[model samples]
Target: MSKAVKCLILLAVIALFFVTELIPLAITAMGGAIACGLLGLIPAKQVFSGLSNSTVVLFAGMFVVGGAMFYTGLAQFIGNKVVSAVGTGENSLMFGLMTVGTVLSAFLSNTGTAACLLPVCLGICASAKIPASRQLMPLAFACGWGGIITMVGTPPNIIAAGALSNVGLPSFGF
Candidate 1:
Protein backbone atom coordinates (compact mmCIF):
# COMPACT_ATOMS: atom_id res chain seq x y z
CA MET A 1 0.00 0.00 0.00
CA SER A 2 1.05 3.63 -0.45
CA LYS A 3 2.52 5.22 2.64
CA ALA A 4 -0.25 7.81 2.93
CA VAL A 5 -3.00 5.21 2.58
CA LYS A 6 -1.30 2.90 5.04
CA CYS A 7 -0.89 5.71 7.52
CA LEU A 8 -4.54 6.66 7.17
CA ILE A 9 -5.60 3.07 7.75
CA LEU A 10 -3.46 2.91 10.86
CA LEU A 11 -4.98 6.13 12.11
CA ALA A 12 -8.47 4.80 11.52
CA VAL A 13 -7.73 1.63 13.47
CA ILE A 14 -6.30 3.63 16.35
CA ALA A 15 -9.28 5.97 16.39
CA LEU A 16 -11.62 3.02 16.43
CA PHE A 17 -9.78 1.46 19.35
CA PHE A 18 -9.87 4.74 21.21
CA VAL A 19 -13.59 5.11 20.68
CA THR A 20 -14.50 1.52 21.46
CA GLU A 21 -11.98 1.22 24.28
CA LEU A 22 -11.48 -2.53 23.74
CA ILE A 23 -7.92 -2.05 24.86
CA PRO A 24 -6.51 0.34 27.43
CA LEU A 25 -6.05 3.84 26.00
CA ALA A 26 -2.35 4.13 26.75
CA ILE A 27 -1.61 0.71 25.36
CA THR A 28 -3.58 1.42 22.23
CA ALA A 29 -1.75 4.70 21.74
CA MET A 30 1.65 3.12 22.19
CA GLY A 31 0.72 0.27 19.95
CA GLY A 32 -0.29 2.66 17.20
CA ALA A 33 3.04 4.52 17.41
CA ILE A 34 4.98 1.27 17.35
CA ALA A 35 2.98 0.12 14.40
CA CYS A 36 3.90 3.30 12.56
CA GLY A 37 7.58 2.66 13.19
CA LEU A 38 7.32 -1.01 12.10
CA LEU A 39 5.45 0.02 8.99
CA GLY A 40 8.17 2.52 8.06
CA LEU A 41 5.76 5.41 8.40
CA ILE A 42 8.22 7.17 10.72
CA PRO A 43 11.79 6.50 11.81
CA ALA A 44 11.83 4.03 14.68
CA LYS A 45 14.18 6.28 16.67
CA GLN A 46 11.82 9.25 16.45
CA VAL A 47 8.75 7.30 17.60
CA PHE A 48 9.61 7.76 21.25
CA SER A 49 11.56 11.01 21.02
CA GLY A 50 8.56 13.08 22.11
CA LEU A 51 8.68 11.35 25.47
CA SER A 52 12.07 12.91 26.19
CA ASN A 53 10.91 16.48 25.58
CA SER A 54 11.04 19.00 28.40
CA THR A 55 7.27 19.34 28.60
CA VAL A 56 6.88 15.61 28.91
CA VAL A 57 9.52 15.53 31.62
CA LEU A 58 7.76 18.31 33.48
CA PHE A 59 4.46 16.43 33.29
CA ALA A 60 6.10 13.21 34.42
CA GLY A 61 7.62 15.00 37.42
CA MET A 62 4.28 16.57 38.26
CA PHE A 63 2.53 13.22 38.06
CA VAL A 64 5.09 11.74 40.41
CA VAL A 65 4.56 14.62 42.81
CA GLY A 66 0.83 14.17 42.59
CA GLY A 67 1.20 10.48 43.25
CA ALA A 68 3.35 11.29 46.24
CA MET A 69 0.65 13.55 47.59
CA PHE A 70 -1.83 10.72 47.39
CA TYR A 71 0.58 8.27 48.94
CA THR A 72 1.34 10.67 51.80
CA GLY A 73 -2.35 11.40 52.45
CA LEU A 74 -1.83 15.07 51.75
CA ALA A 75 -4.40 14.96 48.98
CA GLN A 76 -6.99 13.47 51.34
CA PHE A 77 -6.29 16.08 53.99
CA ILE A 78 -6.57 18.90 51.49
CA GLY A 79 -9.65 17.29 50.01
CA ASN A 80 -11.27 17.09 53.43
CA LYS A 81 -10.59 20.73 54.13
CA VAL A 82 -11.96 21.75 50.76
CA VAL A 83 -15.04 19.56 51.18
CA SER A 84 -15.80 21.04 54.58
CA ALA A 85 -15.27 24.57 53.37
CA VAL A 86 -17.09 24.24 50.05
CA GLY A 87 -19.72 21.65 50.96
CA THR A 88 -20.48 18.59 48.83
CA GLY A 89 -22.81 20.01 46.23
CA GLU A 90 -21.46 19.82 42.66
CA ASN A 91 -21.85 23.51 41.90
CA SER A 92 -20.13 24.63 45.09
CA LEU A 93 -17.29 22.15 44.63
CA MET A 94 -16.77 23.23 41.03
CA PHE A 95 -16.77 26.91 41.96
CA GLY A 96 -14.30 26.33 44.73
CA LEU A 97 -12.02 24.22 42.54
CA MET A 98 -12.03 26.70 39.66
CA THR A 99 -11.46 29.63 42.01
CA VAL A 100 -8.54 27.97 43.70
CA GLY A 101 -7.10 26.84 40.36
CA THR A 102 -7.36 30.36 38.99
CA VAL A 103 -5.73 31.92 42.05
CA LEU A 104 -2.91 29.36 41.98
CA SER A 105 -2.27 29.64 38.26
CA ALA A 106 -2.16 33.46 38.50
CA PHE A 107 0.90 33.15 40.70
CA LEU A 108 2.38 29.89 39.39
CA SER A 109 2.91 28.05 36.12
CA ASN A 110 -0.49 26.85 34.95
CA THR A 111 0.76 23.36 34.16
CA GLY A 112 2.52 23.13 37.50
CA THR A 113 -0.55 24.32 39.36
CA ALA A 114 -2.78 21.83 37.58
CA ALA A 115 -0.38 18.97 38.05
CA CYS A 116 0.00 19.66 41.75
CA LEU A 117 -3.71 20.01 42.24
CA LEU A 118 -4.82 17.03 40.15
CA PRO A 119 -4.55 14.44 42.88
CA VAL A 120 -6.23 16.72 45.39
CA CYS A 121 -9.07 17.26 42.96
CA LEU A 122 -9.37 13.55 42.36
CA GLY A 123 -9.55 12.92 46.06
CA ILE A 124 -12.08 15.66 46.49
CA CYS A 125 -14.23 14.23 43.74
CA ALA A 126 -14.04 10.78 45.21
CA SER A 127 -15.05 11.95 48.67
CA ALA A 128 -17.82 14.07 47.25
CA LYS A 129 -19.02 11.16 45.09
CA ILE A 130 -18.74 13.25 41.95
CA PRO A 131 -17.17 12.30 38.62
CA ALA A 132 -13.72 13.83 38.23
CA SER A 133 -14.48 14.66 34.63
CA ARG A 134 -17.12 17.22 35.54
CA GLN A 135 -14.76 19.38 37.58
CA LEU A 136 -11.38 18.57 36.06
CA MET A 137 -12.20 20.06 32.66
CA PRO A 138 -13.32 23.35 34.16
CA LEU A 139 -10.32 23.40 36.47
CA ALA A 140 -8.02 23.10 33.44
CA PHE A 141 -9.76 26.01 31.76
CA ALA A 142 -9.50 28.16 34.87
CA CYS A 143 -5.77 27.49 35.11
CA GLY A 144 -5.28 28.57 31.51
CA TRP A 145 -7.24 31.75 32.10
CA GLY A 146 -5.28 32.45 35.25
CA GLY A 147 -1.96 32.13 33.43
CA ILE A 148 -2.99 35.11 31.30
CA ILE A 149 -3.40 37.30 34.38
CA THR A 150 0.29 37.70 35.28
CA MET A 151 3.51 38.17 33.31
CA VAL A 152 5.28 35.38 35.14
CA GLY A 153 2.47 32.89 35.13
CA THR A 154 3.28 31.64 31.62
CA PRO A 155 6.12 31.84 29.07
CA PRO A 156 4.01 33.63 26.49
CA ASN A 157 3.49 36.53 28.85
CA ILE A 158 7.22 36.89 29.45
CA ILE A 159 7.94 36.61 25.73
CA ALA A 160 5.33 39.25 24.89
CA ALA A 161 6.70 41.63 27.51
CA GLY A 162 10.25 41.10 26.24
CA ALA A 163 9.14 41.80 22.68
CA LEU A 164 7.51 45.04 23.77
CA SER A 165 10.61 46.16 25.69
CA ASN A 166 12.88 45.30 22.75
CA VAL A 167 10.76 47.61 20.62
CA GLY A 168 11.29 50.45 23.16
CA LEU A 169 7.78 50.10 24.56
CA PRO A 170 6.97 49.87 28.26
CA SER A 171 6.63 46.29 29.46
CA PHE A 172 4.14 44.98 31.93
CA GLY A 173 5.19 44.46 35.55
CA PHE A 174 4.56 41.44 37.79
Candidate 2:
Protein backbone atom coordinates (compact mmCIF):
# COMPACT_ATOMS: atom_id res chain seq x y z
CA MET A 1 0.00 0.00 0.00
CA SER A 2 1.01 3.63 -0.41
CA LYS A 3 2.30 5.67 2.50
CA ALA A 4 -1.00 7.50 2.89
CA VAL A 5 -2.79 4.20 2.62
CA LYS A 6 -0.53 2.78 5.34
CA CYS A 7 -1.27 5.77 7.48
CA LEU A 8 -5.01 5.35 6.99
CA ILE A 9 -4.84 1.65 7.63
CA LEU A 10 -2.81 2.25 10.75
CA LEU A 11 -5.18 4.89 12.02
CA ALA A 12 -8.21 2.76 11.32
CA VAL A 13 -6.70 -0.29 12.97
CA ILE A 14 -5.66 1.62 16.07
CA ALA A 15 -8.93 3.47 16.31
CA LEU A 16 -10.73 0.17 16.11
CA PHE A 17 -8.61 -1.19 18.92
CA PHE A 18 -9.51 1.79 21.07
CA VAL A 19 -13.20 1.66 20.17
CA THR A 20 -13.27 -1.99 21.10
CA GLU A 21 -11.38 -1.40 24.33
CA LEU A 22 -9.50 -4.61 23.80
CA ILE A 23 -6.28 -3.40 25.39
CA PRO A 24 -5.04 -0.63 27.62
CA LEU A 25 -4.94 2.76 25.88
CA ALA A 26 -1.26 3.27 26.49
CA ILE A 27 -0.43 -0.15 25.16
CA THR A 28 -2.38 0.57 22.02
CA ALA A 29 -0.58 3.87 21.57
CA MET A 30 2.81 2.23 22.04
CA GLY A 31 1.92 -0.43 19.51
CA GLY A 32 0.94 2.25 17.04
CA ALA A 33 4.23 4.07 17.56
CA ILE A 34 6.20 0.90 16.95
CA ALA A 35 4.18 0.11 13.88
CA CYS A 36 4.74 3.61 12.55
CA GLY A 37 8.48 3.15 12.76
CA LEU A 38 8.43 -0.35 11.33
CA LEU A 39 6.21 0.61 8.44
CA GLY A 40 8.28 3.70 7.60
CA LEU A 41 5.41 5.98 8.58
CA ILE A 42 7.73 7.89 10.87
CA PRO A 43 11.41 8.05 11.64
CA ALA A 44 12.86 5.70 14.24
CA LYS A 45 13.75 8.68 16.41
CA GLN A 46 10.14 9.79 16.50
CA VAL A 47 8.93 6.35 17.45
CA PHE A 48 11.39 6.27 20.34
CA SER A 49 10.85 9.87 21.39
CA GLY A 50 8.44 8.85 24.14
CA LEU A 51 11.31 7.26 26.05
CA SER A 52 13.73 10.22 25.85
CA ASN A 53 11.24 13.02 26.38
CA SER A 54 11.36 15.26 29.41
CA THR A 55 7.75 14.43 30.20
CA VAL A 56 8.75 10.80 30.52
CA VAL A 57 11.50 11.89 32.89
CA LEU A 58 8.95 13.81 34.92
CA PHE A 59 6.77 10.72 35.14
CA ALA A 60 9.73 8.61 36.29
CA GLY A 61 10.61 11.22 38.87
CA MET A 62 7.03 11.25 40.12
CA PHE A 63 7.08 7.47 40.45
CA VAL A 64 10.34 7.67 42.42
CA VAL A 65 8.89 10.37 44.64
CA GLY A 66 5.84 8.21 45.20
CA GLY A 67 8.14 5.36 46.27
CA ALA A 68 9.87 7.73 48.66
CA MET A 69 6.53 8.81 50.08
CA PHE A 70 5.63 5.18 50.76
CA TYR A 71 9.08 4.30 52.10
CA THR A 72 8.91 7.23 54.49
CA GLY A 73 5.47 6.09 55.68
CA LEU A 74 3.81 9.24 54.44
CA ALA A 75 1.05 7.42 52.56
CA GLN A 76 0.33 5.14 55.48
CA PHE A 77 0.29 8.06 57.85
CA ILE A 78 -2.11 9.89 55.58
CA GLY A 79 -4.34 6.87 55.31
CA ASN A 80 -4.33 6.30 59.04
CA LYS A 81 -5.03 9.93 59.72
CA VAL A 82 -7.97 9.93 57.37
CA VAL A 83 -9.39 6.74 58.83
CA SER A 84 -8.95 8.13 62.29
CA ALA A 85 -10.69 11.34 61.37
CA VAL A 86 -13.56 9.62 59.64
CA GLY A 87 -14.07 6.82 62.19
CA THR A 88 -14.06 3.36 60.67
CA GLY A 89 -17.32 1.87 59.45
CA GLU A 90 -17.71 0.06 56.15
CA ASN A 91 -18.99 3.14 54.32
CA SER A 92 -16.43 5.39 55.94
CA LEU A 93 -13.65 2.94 55.17
CA MET A 94 -14.41 2.80 51.48
CA PHE A 95 -14.89 6.53 51.37
CA GLY A 96 -11.59 7.09 53.13
CA LEU A 97 -9.71 4.88 50.72
CA MET A 98 -11.36 6.49 47.74
CA THR A 99 -10.63 9.92 49.14
CA VAL A 100 -6.98 9.10 49.66
CA GLY A 101 -6.69 7.59 46.22
CA THR A 102 -8.27 10.69 44.69
CA VAL A 103 -6.18 13.19 46.63
CA LEU A 104 -2.88 11.44 46.13
CA SER A 105 -3.51 10.77 42.48
CA ALA A 106 -3.85 14.51 42.00
CA PHE A 107 -0.15 14.81 42.82
CA LEU A 108 1.36 11.35 42.47
CA SER A 109 1.35 8.37 40.15
CA ASN A 110 -2.00 6.59 39.71
CA THR A 111 -0.26 3.23 39.76
CA GLY A 112 1.69 4.36 42.77
CA THR A 113 -1.47 5.50 44.51
CA ALA A 114 -2.98 2.09 43.85
CA ALA A 115 0.16 0.42 45.13
CA CYS A 116 0.22 2.55 48.24
CA LEU A 117 -3.39 1.74 49.01
CA LEU A 118 -3.34 -1.99 48.18
CA PRO A 119 -2.51 -3.28 51.66
CA VAL A 120 -4.75 -0.80 53.33
CA CYS A 121 -7.59 -1.65 50.96
CA LEU A 122 -7.20 -5.33 51.74
CA GLY A 123 -7.27 -4.62 55.44
CA ILE A 124 -10.47 -2.67 55.04
CA CYS A 125 -12.02 -5.41 52.96
CA ALA A 126 -11.08 -8.10 55.45
CA SER A 127 -12.32 -6.08 58.39
CA ALA A 128 -15.54 -5.09 56.66
CA LYS A 129 -16.14 -8.56 55.22
CA ILE A 130 -16.33 -7.12 51.73
CA PRO A 131 -15.09 -9.09 48.74
CA ALA A 132 -11.70 -7.96 47.58
CA SER A 133 -12.70 -8.44 43.95
CA ARG A 134 -15.82 -6.29 44.22
CA GLN A 135 -14.15 -3.34 45.91
CA LEU A 136 -10.84 -3.33 44.07
CA MET A 137 -12.36 -2.40 40.72
CA PRO A 138 -14.11 0.63 42.15
CA LEU A 139 -10.91 1.74 43.85
CA ALA A 140 -9.02 1.27 40.60
CA PHE A 141 -11.57 3.31 38.68
CA ALA A 142 -11.44 6.02 41.30
CA CYS A 143 -7.68 6.14 41.09
CA GLY A 144 -7.74 6.37 37.31
CA TRP A 145 -10.21 9.25 37.43
CA GLY A 146 -8.27 10.88 40.22
CA GLY A 147 -5.12 10.72 38.16
CA ILE A 148 -6.77 12.97 35.59
CA ILE A 149 -7.40 15.63 38.17
CA THR A 150 -3.83 16.86 37.62
CA MET A 151 -1.27 16.79 34.88
CA VAL A 152 1.26 14.59 36.63
CA GLY A 153 -1.15 11.92 37.78
CA THR A 154 -0.39 9.76 34.77
CA PRO A 155 2.05 9.70 31.83
CA PRO A 156 -0.61 10.38 29.23
CA ASN A 157 -1.60 13.57 30.99
CA ILE A 158 2.05 14.55 31.15
CA ILE A 159 2.41 13.82 27.45
CA ALA A 160 -0.62 15.98 26.70
CA ALA A 161 0.76 18.74 28.89
CA GLY A 162 4.06 18.58 27.07
CA ALA A 163 2.42 18.66 23.68
CA LEU A 164 0.36 21.67 24.62
CA SER A 165 3.43 23.39 26.02
CA ASN A 166 5.27 22.75 22.78
CA VAL A 167 2.56 24.67 21.00
CA GLY A 168 3.10 27.67 23.29
CA LEU A 169 0.48 26.87 25.83
CA PRO A 170 1.07 27.30 29.55
CA SER A 171 2.71 24.54 31.55
CA PHE A 172 0.52 22.38 33.72
CA GLY A 173 1.85 22.18 37.23
CA PHE A 174 1.32 19.05 39.25
**lDDT per residue (tens digit) for residues 1-174 in model 2:** 799999999999999999998999989989999999999999988998768888778878988888898789886687578668766676676677778888888788898888778877786667667677765776787788999998888878888778889999886775
For residues 63-121, could you state the per-residue lDDT of candidate 1 as single tens digits?
56546765797656766777888998999999888888887677667787787778889
Q: What is the lDDT of residue 16 in candidate 1?
A: 100
Model 2: lDDT equals 0.82
The worst-scoring run of ten residues by lDDT in candidate 2 lies at: 85-94
Candidate 1 lowest-lDDT run of ten: 53-62
TM of each candidate vs. truth: 0.56, 0.64
